[model samples]
Target: MEEPGKIKLTIPCRLDHVHLAGHAIKGVLAETIKDSELVFLIELAVCEAVSNSMQHAHGCNADCNVEVSIFLCNSELVIEVTDTGAPFNADLLKNKQCHDPEDATCEKAAEGGRGIFLICRAMDEVKYKSFADRNILTMRKTIKPTDRDGEP
Candidate 1:
């Protein structure tokens, strides 16, 4: 069993596995929070991150494991996706902005590279690292109280 504020689930790095992960996460968020929009955003961010690993990191050649850890603290949701695969080019994402959707560059037209862009835009914060043969991507989104006067 998980603690009150944390949930951890692991799924195989297969195309179908993404659906299970998404469903589990969405359920948890729904049960824990009253706001549905926030829940959907978190779910989408996680799905994209895991999908990227299944498609690009594993190259669809070998079975892989994706470990998802979600924790809620002070109304903030933190999600991490970790996988064992070839190291990713973290520099490419950090150095370049998401292609202007209208840009006609070859890289922008490619399917594989756009996953990171979607992940970045979907979450409030996105970070990546390659450590000890694992690629870890962490995304964070905060849920502000409806009465709060400040912007999230």
Candidate 2:
């Protein structure tokens, strides 16, 4: 549930576009938010998600686009990223396991493919959907007044 004065921002999916998204999130938090910790958390989460799209979703192709939307509603902040890249096997993520420290797989040792894991850990809710050639990821974080009061 968003409060009465909810904020919404939408940006196109270009590598250059993330700067706009990041700026929007920071601007809103600075202008209206009173809690520093919560503001930082939301901003970081947005960065990770957008970075995933900018870096991985296009596989280095500069022509592809990724759409981003952010909204602050009553007690929740919602962010969505959508891309038209080839459909990915979401199950690959669901079944992923941490590699053994002694015998890490070559793929696991690589710098890619960790975004989903980070998103899962950092956000309260994560969902993926594919429709009409687009991959949509939605993430939410619950904001409590106590979260601002320094209560764990």
Candidate 3:
């Protein structure tokens, strides 16, 4: 069984193992997140971050590891996705920002250039850090305390 407030998972940097992170994360969220809509949004945000790292950091290579750490606090959930790969520049997205700001153009967004935007849209907070040896993307979502059946 996973811990109550914290969950940790590491998987290969490949599209195939992405679901492993998702499945384990859902188990944790199921215990805390009482709203189905919010659960789905959180899952999507997590997946986007993982997919981005897998694609950008490792170039879909399955040899490296992508670590996902999830922390559930009183009324919020914070998740971090970390990868060991080439340093990334978060400013790239800022430079590619669309006039609308919230999302890039359909052409770019549809081409998988909007992972950051989609993550930002789905979660309450999104942050990125590229350290000397690792890249970490953190996302947080506010959880509404409802019944155990995931009803608001």
Tell me the whole-model lDDT of each prediction, alpha carbons only.
0.76, 0.68, 0.79
For candidate 1, lDDT tens digit of each residue in 1-152? 77787788878877877988889888877656666766676788888888888877887544678889898777687888888887677775674366536757776575546667767766788889998888999888876776122423
Quote the positional error of residue 12 for candidate 1 in Å: 1.0
Q: Output the worst ten-in-a-row residue range by lDDT, candidate 3.
A: 93-102
Q: List ranges where model 3 is wrong by over 4 Å.
A: 1-4, 92-110, 146-152
lDDT of 2 by residue, 1-152 (tens): 74465455544556567677777777775654667766776677677777676676676456666676767765677778787776666774464353223477776586666656666766788788889988888888887766543345
Top model number, TM-score: 3
Better of 1 and 3 by lDDT: 3
> Against the true structure, whose lDDT is highest?
3
In model 2, the clashing pairs are 1-74, 2-73, 2-74, 3-74, 13-66
lDDT ranking, best first = 3, 1, 2
Q: Which 10 residues in a row give candidate 2 its minimum summed lDDT?
A: 93-102
Every model's TM-score: 0.79, 0.69, 0.80
What tens-digit string does per-residue lDDT give for candidate 3 at 42-73? 78888888988898888988889999999988
Residue 23's C-alpha lDDT in candidate 2? Answer: 76
Better of 1 and 3 by TM-score: 3
Error of 2 at 87 (Å): 2.5
